[model samples]
Target: MKTADIQPFFATLKAANPSPQTELEYTSVFELLAAVLLSAQATDVGVNKATRKLFPVANTPQAILALGLESLEGYIKTIGLFRSKAKHLMETCRILVERHDGQVPDTREALEALPGVGRKTANVVLNVAFGQPTMAVDTHIFRVSNRTGLAPGKNPLEVEKQLMRRVPGDYAVDSHHWLILLGRYVCQARKPRCWECLVSSYCDYSPKTPPPQGSLR
Candidate 1:
């Protein structure tokens, strides 16, 4: 996709939902950070289900630290890597309390310095929590970036850089969520639903799938 095409594409997305929010439910920055950390290799549905219970009891870094890793595991065991995630969560909380005064850090470097928080997680925190225009390339975004000729790259970091360079400023803030949801629901890995995709016309995927014959939604 050309630089010119990017603006209208995001305009359509924003028009559909003016204030698109992260599917992972959280009431505070700390909760959002912890939920995103646990979301690796997990689904939003599962993360939300777990956090709905966890957040009520411990919504801050210091509070979660006091919850202890064993108790934390009980709540998030349904998620994959619960043991490691629990440990990371506790350690991150400790770092937050000791270094950042129990608040979720706003800077990428500071956020990344916390356990379980990397570039992807930090990008999400900055964008969703702080309303910055950073884009975090997850599997879905990576696939969409390449499949749509929007920002093709072999690695997530490279793709992220391309997207940052190419995406229009007006849409950059919410493009992360738009691209992720588009790939998760429409541009699926097994069988992309190209037939009903809103951005199918702009996509560069070859031999796009057509809607079933005589079928209407």
Candidate 2:
């Protein structure tokens, strides 16, 4: 997309959903961090399903550690890579309790130091929990950025850099959420629902797909 179209593109998204939020359900910063950690290759729905059950039982770092590794694994066993994710969560909880007094760290350096927390996970926590303008380039964001010519790049890090530099300041903090939602629901990977896309006019993709037969606009 052109530099000029960027403003209206995000403006439209904001108008449609003024306050976008992560699909992952969490009541606290630690819960958000844990949910993101468990969501590596899992869907938000799956993560939420597990967290809904787990958080009430063990929401805090100390509480999670008290649950023991086996119980933690049992709670999240439905998710993909549960064993490894549970181990990472256990290790991360230990670090949080021992080093940070059981509180979720705000700095990127501190957040990334946890065993399961990568740049992407750190970005999610920083953006959603701390209101930072960091972009967490997940599969949806990556696909939307490349497909719309908004911030095309070869990798997540490259795409993240592009978005940080290109997105307007007013929209930066929430742009990742908007893009993720757009990609998840409209600009889909297998076949984009261009016919119903609200911002398709500003998208760089050509030959937009038509509505399916008998489907109403």
Q: Which stretches of candidate 2 lie over 4 Å from their true place?
A: none
lDDT of 1 by residue, 17-130 (tens): 788788999888988999999999999999999999999898888888889989999999999999999999999999989988888889999999988888999999999999
Scored by lDDT, model 2 comes in at 0.97
Candidate 1 runs further than 4 Å off: none
> What TM-score does prediction 2 earn?
0.99
Clashes in model 2: which pairs? none
Where's the lowest-lDDT run of ten residues in candidate 2? 201-210
196 Cα displacement, candidate 2 (Å)? 0.9
Candidate 2 lDDT over 98-132, as tens digits, reads 99999999999999999999999999999999999
What's model 2's lDDT at 197? 97
